[model samples]
Target: MTITIRSALMKNFLGDSPDWYKWVIISFLLLNPLVFFLVSPFVAGWLLVVQFIFTLAMALKCYPLQPGGLLAIEATLIGMTSPAHIGEEIANNLEVLLLLIFMVAGIYFMKQLLLFLFTKLLLSIRSKMLLSLAFCGAAAFLSAFLDALTVIAVVISVGTGFYAIYYNVVAKQADNNSQIADDSLIDNPEHQQIMEQFRSFLRSLLMHAGIGTALGGVMTMVGEPQNLIIAKNAGWGFVEFFLHMTPVTLPVFVCGLLVCLLVERFRLFDYGTKLPEPVREVLKEFDRKASAKRNRQDKVKLVIQALVGVWLVVALAFHLAEVGLIGLSVIILVTSFCGVTDEHDIGKAFQEALPFTALLTVFFTVVAIIIEQQLFSPVIQFVLQAPPSTQISLFYLFNGLLSSVSDNVFVGTVYINEARAALEQGLISLKQFEMLAVAINTGTNLPSVATPNGQAAFLFLLTSSLAPLLRISYGRMVWMALPYTLVLTLVGLLCVHYALVPVTEWLTQWNWISPPSLNVISSVTAH
Candidate 1:
C-alpha cells in the first residue's frame, strides 16, 4: 500500500519532496491542552477532530514513520484512525458537567438576591448576627455545591461584592460611599506594574471556589456533571444518583460551610489588610447593600426556597419521564418561567445563557458520538482490562489529577463509562464499580480548586471576582485543600467500599449494615 502511494505520489509530482518535519510539529501541537479545557467547551468534538487530522496527516500524508520500527510503533498508537472518538467522548462528559454548573450559576444568583431580601426583612429584628451569617452561609453553601464560580460571577465587590456586576462600577460606588484617606495607588504605577500579580490573585480565589464546588458536587448529582456521567454510565439515572450522592453531600455541606466561612472569616489575606482602605470600605458598604438587597428579595427567595425543596423531585421527573438534556433544560425554563414569583426581581436568567447554553448542548452531542465510536478505545481498553482494583484506583487518581486541568465531571464520567463497560462485559464486577465510583467521584473535587481551567473555576477568576479579592494560589490551594481532600477521600472510600464490597462474614455478624458507623468513617486511612 505504501509503495503504491509513493509511486502515485512520484507520478503526481512534488510528493517526493513533502516536508516531513511538518508532520512532527503537527503531532506536538495537536496535543495541546486547549482541547480538554478550551475548545471542548465551545465546539465539542472540534478537539478530537484536531487530534485525528494531525495523526493522519503525520502518519499517512506525511509518511514520517518507517514501515516497522519504534517510530512505526509510536505512529500506530498515536495514529488513532478509528471512527470512534476519545476527544468527543471526553467532551460530552464535560457537557453534562457544564449543565450542573449552569444550575449552580443560576442558583448562586438566586441565593444572592434572596439573601439580600432576607437581610432586608430582618431590619426590624436580629439582622445583624443572624442575617449576616445566614446570607454568608447561603452563599458559601451554594459555592460549595455548584462551584464557587457561580457565586463569583454575580458578586463584583471583589471579595465582598463577589456576587455583583461591573466591578469597576461597584468600585466607583464604593468610592462614592466610603470615606477613604485617598490612597495614591489609584493614580500610581507601582501597584499596577504586575498584571500577572493581579491575575494570580484572582486565580487563587478561583482555586478555593473550584475546590468548593468539586467537593460540593459530591453532595448531589446537581452539584456537577461527573455524577450524571457516573449515573448514565451505570444506567441507573436520578434515584441511583441521589442515593449515592445525598449522604456524601450532606456531610460535605457541613465541611464546606466551615471551610468557606472560616477561610473568608479569618481574612488569612494580610490580616484583612491586603485590600486597600478604599476596597475595604467598599466591601463593608456592599455588605450593607447586600443586607438591604436581601430585604427586597422576597420573590426570589420564594422561588429558590421552592427550588431547593423540589430540586430532587423535579430532577427525577426528567428520568421517570425519560427526557434528555434538552427536555430537562426546557423543564427548568418552563417551570422557572411559570413560577415567575419575582418576574421583577432576578432579571432574565437565560438571556446571556443561550450562547453558552447552545455551546454546551451541541458539545455533548459530539461527545456522545466519540464515546460511541471509541476513538480512544485503545487506551480505554487498557484501563478497563486492568485488574479491577488497579482500574478503580487509577480511575480515582486520574480523576483527581486531570480535574486540575480539565473538568472532573467529564473526566470522571468517562472513567465511569469505561468501568461500567468492563463490569457489564464481565471484565469487572458491579461491586468493584460501586467502590470505584465513590472513591473517584469523591476525589474529583480536588481539581476544581487546583486550577482555573474548570468552568466554575474559570468564572471565579473573572477580574471582578474573588480571585483578585482573595489572591488565592495553586500552591496555597493544595495546602488549604489537603485536609479536606484526605478527610473526604477516606470517608468516601470506606462508604463506597462498604457499598461495593461484600461485608466480611465476621463483620456482618455485628449487624454492621448501618452505613458504616461514624467511628468507621473517622477511622478510614487517609493514605
Candidate 2:
C-alpha cells in the first residue's frame, strides 16, 4: 500500500512539472512583444518559441551545442524560434506587413504623379530619345545622390504619366480615325473603339526611359544599392566612388541606349495610334486648371528644381566636409521650405522613409552580424575572387535571375556590401566594382515585374493608375519588359565596357603597386 501511494505521488509530480513548464512558455510568449517597449530587457516570440523548443529538444537529445562559428546562427535560431505570445507574434508580423504596404504604396503613388508629368512634357516636346536622355541624366544624378529605388520610382512614374496623357488625351484628338471611333463608340459602335491617339511610338520610348534611368544609376556611388555598400565597405568617398564606378556606368549607358533603340524597334509593333489632338487639349486643360488653382504645378516645379539644386549643393558640402547624410537632409529641408516646397512635403518624405527604414536596418544589421560571424564570409569571398570582368558580367546575369526571388532593394544592398568588400580587397577595383553595380542594379529592376512574386510596387502602381485610361495588361507588361530586358542587358554591358572598364583597368593597374587589401577580413577586424 505504501509503495502504491509513493508511485501515485511520483506520477502526479511528473505531470505537474509539464503543466508548469507549458504555463511558463505561455507566459513568455505573451510578454515577448511587450519587451520591445522595454529598453531594459530582451524578449522574443513569434513561432520563435516553438522553434526554440524544437531546436533545444533535438539538439539536447541528438547532439551537443558547440561554441564558435555556428553560435550566432544558433542564437538567432533560438531567439527567433522561442515560443512567444501568439498575440505578440501576430502584432509584430502585422507591423512588418503594414510597413511593406506603406513602402509599396508610397513609391507607387509618387511614381504615378511623376509619370503623369513626364508624359505631359513628352507631349509638349514630342521627342522620345530627348526625353529618354534627359530622364537618364536625371536618374543617374539622382541615383548618385539619393537611393536608386526612390529615383526610379519618381522617374518611372513620370515616364508612365507623360505618355499616358499624350495617349489618353493628347494623341487621341489628333489621330486619323479617332474622331469617327469616338463618335461611333458614343452613339452606336459597329467595331471595337480604337483608343490609340497619343504617340504610340513614344510608348516604346517610355521603355527606353526605364532603361536609361536604370543604366544611369550605375554611373556613381550614390546611384544604386551595391555601390552604396561598396562605398561604405571599401571606405570610398565621392571622388573615388565616381572614379571607380565610371568604367561600368559609361559602357552600360551607351550600350543600353543602342539596345533600347533596337528593342524599341520591336516595341514599334505597338503601332496602335499616333499623335492625337486631345493631348494638346489636355495640356491646355492642365494649364488652365493649374493656372486657376494659383498655378500650383508650375510654381511647384520651379521650387522643386531650385530645392533639388540646393539639395545637391548641400549634399556635396556634407560629403566634402564629411558631415554625413544628416547634415545634407537638414540643409535640404531648410532650403526646401524657402517659398517653394512645403514643410509638410518634406516631413512626409522623412515619415515615408520611416516605414521601411527600421525594418530594413534590422535586416541589414542581421546580415552584418552574420558576416561578422564569418559564416557568410566564405560565399562573399568566393564571389569577390572571381575576375572583375567575370564578376561584372556575372553580376548582371545573377542579379537578373535572382531579382525574381527577392526585392530589388534587398538584392541591391547585399550586392553593394559584397562588391565593396571585393573592391577593398583588390579582387575588383572601384571601376570594375561600379561595372558590377550597374549590371546588377539594372538586372534587379527589369525582373521585378516578371511575376506577382517578383512584381514590385512600381508595377502595381503603374497598372492601377493607368488601367482606367490606357488599358495596359499584366501580360503586356511582362511581355514589354522582356524586350526591355534583352535590349537593356546588351546595351548595359556595352556601356560598362566602353565607358568605365578601360578607365578602371588603368586605375587598378596603376594602383597595383600599393596592392589593395583584397581580403575584406583585415578591414573589418584587427586581425
Candidate 3:
C-alpha cells in the first residue's frame, strides 16, 4: 500500500511526462543545495537557469510554467534570489505584463476582421510565392507599429479558424461515408496525404509571418518593449529612433522579404508546400458560404474593427499612452460595439492570453535570479574593455549570443545600463556612447531570432494552441528561422561595425541630432 501510494504521487508530479524526465527534474532540485554549499551560489544559480531552459526546450512535452515555477520557488528559498527581488523585477517590467494581458485579448475581438481579410487574400492569390510574401510583409508592417505577440495572435487565429473549418467538413464527410461503404473518408490514403500537405502549407506561412515580426520588431522604438527602454535611456524620440535603426533594420527588412520569396521558390527549409487541390476547394466553398451569409450587421462589425485597428496604429505611432492602455481601450471599444458583452464571451478572450501571462511572470523570476547572481557581469566587463573601434561589433555579437539563450529585454537592459554608466563616468565619448546604444538595441532585437527562448513573441507562438494544431514544434521553428537568423545577424553586424559611426556623424551634421557638447545624455539616460 505504501509503495503504491508513492508511485501514484510520483506519477502526479509531472502528469503524463515520462518518469525519466520527472527524475531528472527531481535530481536537479536535489543537487542545487549541495552545489550552493560546496561550490558557490553563482554556480548553483547558473545550473538552475540551465535546468529552467531545459524545461522550455521541452515545451511540447509539458508546459514549462509548472516545472519552471517550481525551480523558481526553490531558488527563492535557497537564497539565490529573494521574493523582494522578484517583485522588483516584476515592477520594472510591469508594462510588458499588462501588454500581454490586454493586447492579446484585445486582438481576440478583431479575429473576424483578420480572418476575413486573410481569407480573401488566400483565395485571390494563386502563386504560393506571392501568398507567402504577402503574409510575411503584412505581418512585418503590423508588428512595426503594434506588439509582435498581438500580431502573431491574429495570424494564429486565422490559421486555426481555417483549419477548424476544414476539419469539421472532413468529419461530416467521414460520418456520411460510414453509412455507404468501407472506404470511408478517414481511410482514404489520398485524403490523408492532402491533409498532411495542408498542414505543411499552414506551417510554412505561419513560420514566415513569425520571422517577419522579428524583422520588423527591430526597426522602431515601438517595435518592441525593449526598444522603448533603449530609446528612453538614449533620449530618442520616435523619429530619431527610426532614423538610427534604419541603417540596419531597413536593409534586413528587404532581405527578409526576399528570403521569404526565395525560400518558397526553391522549397527550402520545408517552405514550398502547396495547398492540396481538394483542401483548396473546401476552403473556397467555405469562403463562398461565409460571404453569402454575411448580413448588414456583420459588415458593420468588420468596419468597426477596421477603424479600431487604424486607431491602434495611430495611437502607437504618436505614443499616446502605454501600449497596454491603448490595447485596453481597443478591447473596450471593439467589444462594446461588436456585441461581445456577454460574460462568457469576454471570459473566453482571456483564456489564450492569461496562461502565457503566467508563464511570463515565471520567466521574470528566472531573470531575477540571473540579476541576483551577476550571471552576465563578466561578459559586459569583457565587452567594455575592447578597443573602441571594435566595441560595437563585439557588443553586437555578445548581446546576440546571450539573447539567444536568455531574455533579450533583460540582456538589453543590463548592457544599456552598463554603457550609460560608462558614459556618465566619462569613460567613453558621447558619440561612442550613441553608437554603442544603437548596437545594443539592434543586437538584442536582430539576432535573438535564432531561438524562441530569446524572444517573447516566438515563445508565445511556440506555446500557442495553434502550434500543436499546425504541427509547429520547437526544433521545427528553429530550423525554419535559420535563414533569416543568418541574414539578419551578418547584415546587422556589418552595419554596426561600419555604418553606425558614419550615420551618426551625418545626422549630427544635418542638425537632426544634438551636438556632443549639449549634455543631452543627462536627459536621455534618466531611466
- Report how far residue 294 has shifted in candidate 3, in Å: 1.4
Which of candidates 1 and 3 is the stronger one according to TM-score?
3
Stretches of model 3 off by over 4 angstroms after superposition: 1-3, 164-184, 237-239, 406-410, 417-434, 455-473, 511-527
Per-residue lDDT of 407-426 in model 1, one digit per residue for the tens? 55445655666555555566
TM-score of each: 0.55, 0.59, 0.87
lDDT of 3 at 34: 91
lDDT by residue (tens digit), candidate 2, 223-272: 44444444444445566666665555455556555554444334443522
Error of 1 at 182 (Å): 11
Instruction: Kindly give the stretch of ten consecutive residues in candidate 2 with the minimal lDDT sum.
Output: 60-69
Instruction: List all candidate RMSDs to the true structure.
Output: 12.3, 13.5, 3.7
Q: lDDT values of the candidates? A: 0.45, 0.46, 0.80
For model 2, what is the error of residue 142's alpha carbon versus the real structure, in angstroms, after optimal superposition?
4.2
Better of 1 and 2 by lDDT: 2
The true-versus-predicted C-alpha distance at residue 41 of model 2, in Å, is 26
Model 1 / residue 308 / CA error / Å:
8.0
Report residue 191 deviation for candidate 3 (angstroms): 3.5
